[model samples]
Target: MTTALTLTAAPGPDGVIVLTAAGEIDMSNAEAFAEALTSAVTGATGSRLIVDLTEVHYLDSAGLAALFAQADQIELRTGPLLAPLLEVSGLAELTTVHQA
Candidate 1:
């Protein structure tokens, strides 16, 4: 069964695109997450893409992979709970990760 996940997109300061994700992100909903991210990126009016993961309670490998697929074009803002995991997974190197 697919887990509940919510994605919101909006324009940030200085023309940046911010994509906020809430709820859990796992294999069941990774594809949806990817599509949302892709849409946000494609429709963005700026070169910077910020993915806010502060409200996300959980994320699995599949979700991580989806993010990684767009790592080159995105920056990530994460909560303390997922900071270490992102670092250990080397995602921090692939993209900018701001820990909160």
Candidate 2:
């Protein structure tokens, strides 16, 4: 099993990119994950950002907020942020209904 949460990012066709994260996200690594998302969004423009959390088995409020913050960052950059996929296995109560 993967010992650490792996955050992988790759650009898709038409400037669209997917940031795929797996494993557990909590306070310890939340900031790093958030920074990663922030960097990804900041590095690109006028593209669609899709964060795929299908492999993410667990999450917390910090993680959820970090993800949403990425969405906001993308939008502020004029990048079209796609609907996030929180997957089926994981669950979290967040102000962002789009997450649920």
lDDT of each candidate versus the true structure? 0.93, 0.60
Clashing pairs in 2: none
* C-alpha lDDT of residue 29 in model 2: 86
RMSD of each: 1.2, 7.5
Best TM-score among the predictions, by candidate number: 1
TM of each candidate vs. truth? 0.94, 0.66
Candidate 1: residue 33 Cα off by (Å): 0.1
Candidate 2 lDDT trough over 10 residues, lowest sum: 75-84
* Model 2 residue 73 distance off true place after TM-score fit, in angstroms: 4.9
Please, what are the lDDT tens digits per residue for candidate 1 over residues 46-95? 57899999999999999999999999999999999999989999999999
The prediction achieving the highest lDDT against the true structure is 1
Question: Residues 1-100, candidate 2, lDDT per residue (tens digit)?
Answer: 3237898878867567767787888787898889888877766667656666666777767776686655443321111122233333132222222331
- The TM-score measured for candidate 2 stands at 0.66
After superposition, the stretches of candidate 2 with alpha carbons farther than 4 Å from their true spots are: 1-3, 73-100
- Report the Cα lDDT for residue 25, model 2: 80
Q: Which stretches of candidate 1 lie over 4 Å from their true place?
A: none
